[model samples]
Target: MIEGLEPWAQQGLGAATGLAIGLLVGLERGFKLRRQKEGKRVAGVRTFSLLGLGAGLAGVVAETQPIAAAVILLAMLGYLAIAYAPRLTSGGDATSPVAAAVTVVAAFLAGLGNVGLAGAAAAILVFILALKDEIHQFVDRLEERDIHAIARYGIIALAVLPFLPNEEMGPYGAWNPTKLWWVVIIVTGFSFAGYVANRLFGARHGTIATALIGGAYSSTAVTQSLAQRLGQTKGGGAEPAGIALASAVMYLRVIVLVAILANRILLPFVILLAPALIVAWVAGWWLYRQAEPSDAPAPPGNPIALVPALGFVVFIAIAAVAARWAQGQFGEQGIAILLFLMGSMDVDASIVTAGGLPPDLIGAELAAIAIGGTIIANMAVKIGVTLAYARRNGWSAALALLASTLVLAGSIAVAWLRL
Candidate 1:
């Protein structure tokens, strides 16, 4: 009898302690709720406190008897409350389930604490609850397209990711779908971050700001978007000045790629590029301010591209082959030439290939230079595309943009070459 009594007393103490913690946290919330009278779809502090206390009591009683029977009884009561909640709650808000979840947690904690677990869970729970509004607002601001991007990420992770063969594929054991997918995930995550930052900080900051954020998504996409948006003119004319100004942001983006791929070399590039970028910004902003209509739509490029999983895989495959061939035939110089050439078609492909090149085959700076050259090649392509696509395709703005791009390219090259 004394042994039994000891276990009961210990269980009872733990149950009481769990109840106290839950009640203290709940009471503070309840007082705040009552004072504000702001209706959320959640039960107040007293309800939470009672739920926790009752759960602890239930757990203590269950230890001596049929655990399954106690669970069944609790389930029936829980179901009844949930079923009745919709009818009982008149101005039913979104938070009611959150409150119910807290009740469930409190019960779980009571049971776990009886087993000597659940250390400081209540404190962590309170901290999470405090940040509820900020979390919700952030999720709410997320664009539908951005949501799709996240879903794509999930598909890549949960679905396509696991099924893919992990071993290297092709002739030289150089390609792995799993590895490529990992890169896709990384790029996708970065793109999503850029998108959110763009939305938050670049909303009204100006086209230059948009380009900076957009470039993070893809500089090509950014260039196309800015050209299209800025070329829409008042009455019957296009705005060359506005488009010119946005190109200033493009120069900065070009310079940025060097920093990303090879930071040690970005000093020379950053110095050279900053002046031209700033000059373009000032000149372009002046022109844009003079020419732009107040009611202009946003640019046309998607800030996020779902991380093109398959495309990245294909890129890796081809680049691996090319990298191997370049190493065999022409050494590091040949690899550099290949990277510089292929980079025009897709900068990512060249970078991936160069990254995998044997250390003896290519120095890091030389590889970076090839990648930087590809960026320059891409700039020329974008400029050519914009000239044809733009409504206000003319000599003056074109010359200025061309000059800016050349300077940006030079900055990247110089950085890659030396200190």
Candidate 2:
């Protein structure tokens, strides 16, 4: 936007933006300190506004005089340090002084025509300041494992993901290191988000809420967990309801992953899977209504399971290579067969593989059918797990899933007919 403006106009706009940034942060700070005595507060809206105005004008000058800009920044920093000296020596909170310095820097950036960055920084600063108490309370609730999980996620996402090569390699040139790792990151990130949400709300919201959240990452795992809980006791209807609800969430997760990684198949995939999704949810809600309230089941394990994530990347690579070979050997039909077989064990891997395939190798309709088969196969596995592990106690869940599976099969058949 600024690029089209004359230099004088751009400078005026930049100065105005800087003033707005300052006002935003200053308002928040002033509100927080409203109860304090006037002299006790180091800075307020007026002081901050002047500081921003001075910084913006300095930035305008800096376009031609770099040293002048540096001197202006240093002078502001020096003033802040001196103003905050008594607070520092008294061991009081130093956040205000630091915030003041940041405000000056953001205003300067704005004046330099980096309006986006400056605006974003100022907004974030105000948000952090406003949420001080809530943020601290949240920090207090975090456990050591939770902290470690965060760090692990950071390593994989921020540290490891960027550095990986993006070139295709391995058999049939199927594997791209960055793409595979990205799948891992997406899966793990979902799991982490679910885990954190479960920790925050599962206890108060009861079994159904837990099921919904848990399903975000691994519905199979959620199923097994709830099934085991049921097997141990007479179990309330909520347990079966939770199990069904988690399965419903599985459909939601799959549909989302398909949309993100393989949008070509999304329409057919959703059409084929929507019946099962609806059936599962309806059954779950019915069962939950009949059941008495029960304790929320224990949440899942670690958020970012690094070892499993690495293993998943390897599996995706194998599936991708195997899918390519299958396409070569028997054309599109062979690729469908490959996806169905691989998806029985890992639907996500199959989705990623299908997404990476050449556009001509298989049409979207056929790809969706192949993935639908995998979904059915995966549902069968979960049903078997429920039966084997939960035994008679799991009959309600098994039956609900059975109904969905039947509906899903019928949908696939109808889709096949349309083709």
Candidate 3:
């Protein structure tokens, strides 16, 4: 198509690109201003279209006479300021001319070889304008603590992270401050998302919804929380179902993390873990079906507070050092044992350590064994915590959880035997 066009037509095509983008934006603005008194709108479709055309023409002139193009742009800006000067002085229409100013600049850029950027900015601006009500509502719902939590996350991820040294610092060169902080960021970010979701929807949706959302952050925490609720309610069967569902979600979460960080070992890990996930899901679903309906309050507060994020960073660093030392001293078997011990406390830290290990020291087979051990150990911890905390009414839930774990164990045994 370009080959068929004359040189003048080719240049016209470039100008047309700017014109089309301007028209798209102008059309949206025109619709928005449709109900406004005709003269009240600062600029609508026709005004914006002409502005875009002038900008494009200026850009074409810039190729041969840059100074002339500059003057033309300045003239346009001057005209816009004069046009809105009365409104600015009146103070009745406090609406700033910033958006219109930006649109003109975008139009200039669209002509000056930045059409994509101009178009994207215009589109995003339109979207923000359209979502004004929703944005306001979201802000209105945010509590002081929620704002603080967001600031804390920003400090950790943005302020503190970049200053951390990237070089390995301690314990067999296992601790890289930058890398460790990044892991903290990823984990904390994930937990923050779940925390936000629970806040937004958990009250209306109840136990099952809370379980699923909270599970993404820390299934162990969810399990313990739900178990405590069970004790309070005198063995509400639905609480057990929520616990089981959270556990099931944990397995899938591990699979995703492994696939992302240690993809080569994912198949074996999934083979050993997926059956357990399936068993837990089935048990949870059955329990949900058997239970009476009840409201499960939203889990309290953001789980990714600053102190907890720091604690997790310390925990993960310790786990990584321990796994590295163990691997060096007793090889893969040592790693397996350390991972299981660590997993009993925090499966995420254990799995992350296993995934970060050098492939030579921990091949697919060893990583799989270590990961499997951690998972089984974590399951035991969950069961024990439930039984211990919910002592009065958790017996039935513990039994159900134990049964699921046993079924998972059987599947793992079968997998190992086949191997």
Candidate 4:
């Protein structure tokens, strides 16, 4: 907005922005000290406003006389130190003084013509100050495991990711170390997020809600969890519907991941997968209505185990090599078979493998079939998981998933004919 403005106008605008930022901080401070005796208060809205204005004027002079600006800031800080000395002696908290210091810095930045940064900093400071109690309460709720999980993720994302090379290496140049690690990061991140949500909000709702949240990351894990709950309760009927709902969410989640990492094949993939997605939801809804109410499924284990994360990277690396080999050896047919087999255990690995390939290596139709086949195989695996974990009590969950799989199969067939 200031792009075409004259120099004097820009300076004027900067000064105004600084004053506004100061007024905003001062208002919060004033509210906190509203009950204090007027004469005893060290700072107020008017004082802050004047400080902002003075700082802004000093900044204008700094463009031609930088030493003057430094002197002005030092003099202001000196006054603040003298005024706050009594509070320090009385052992009062330093929040107010620290806030005052921030206000000065932010206004100085605004005066230096960084109005956007100054405004943003001032707003965030106010927000943090306002939420002090809530933030403390949230911190109090953090378990040791939660803190460890946070630190682990920080390492995975911030420490490790940036250091990995982006170039494709290994056999057939099929594996890009950076891309493979990113898959692990994204998949692990999703699972960890679901774990956190389930911990915080799962018990408050019930099995269905837990399924909904868990399904976004790993429907298979959700199935196993709910199936175990069903076993303990001997046909706690809600587990079946919850399992189905998680699978439904999985379909949507798959499409979303596809959209994020590989959009070229998205249209055909969605077309073939849409019917299954709808069927899963419809079947889940029906089963949910028929089942008796049940408690929330037990929380799943933390999904961030380092060994498993490293193992997944290995699997993705293998899948990428195998996919490239299959495409070369048997064309689309070989790749389709490879994808189906891989998807039975881990659909995400197949996705990463396929997404990493050159776009022209497989047309959209074949990509849809390969990914759709994985979904079908994954559903079949979940059905087996239900029966294996829940025994006879899991028939409802098995039936619901079977219906969706049948629908998905039919959709795949239709898509095949069009090819």
Q: Rank the candidates by lDDT, best first.
A: 2, 4, 3, 1
How do the predictions measure up, each by TM-score?
0.64, 0.93, 0.82, 0.85
Q: Judging by TM-score, tell me the better candidate of 1 and 4.
A: 4
Sort every candidate by TM-score, greatest first.
2, 4, 3, 1
Runs with alpha carbons beyond 4 Å of true place in candidate 2: 388-392
Writing each residue's lDDT as its tens digit, candidate 1 over 1-419 gives 11445765766765675566557667656754666546642556666666566666665566565585378437735863775477467654444345445545555456534333433566666666666787787787777876776776677566777777888777667777776676566555555666666665555565555655655656556556655654553222224454555555555554554455445545544565575677667666665555434333353444344445666667778777877876788888888898887778877666556555556777766665666677568667767756665645444456656776677676665665573
Q: What TM-score, to 2 decimals, does candidate 2 have?
A: 0.93
Q: Which stretches of candidate 4 lie above 4 Å from their native place? A: 24-63, 72-107, 117-123, 234-237, 291-293
Query: Where is model 1 more than 4 Å wrong at Cα?
Result: 1-42, 45-91, 99-150, 165-169, 192-212, 234-296, 301-308, 391-400, 412-419
In terms of TM-score, the best-performing candidate is 2
Q: What's the lDDT for residue 390 in model 4?
A: 89
lDDT for 374 (candidate 3): 70
Predicted structure with the largest lDDT when compared to the true one: 2
Task: Write model 2 residue lDDT over 125-244, tens digit each, in one string.
Answer: 998999999889779888899999999898888889878998988878888898888888887887788888887888678888889999888888888888888888786658899989
Q: How accurate is candidate 2 locally (lDDT)?
A: 0.87
- Predictions in order: lDDT: 0.60, 0.87, 0.76, 0.84
Q: After superposition, how far is residue 371 of candidate 4 from its true place, in Å?
A: 1.5
RMSD each, Å: 7.7, 2.1, 3.9, 3.3
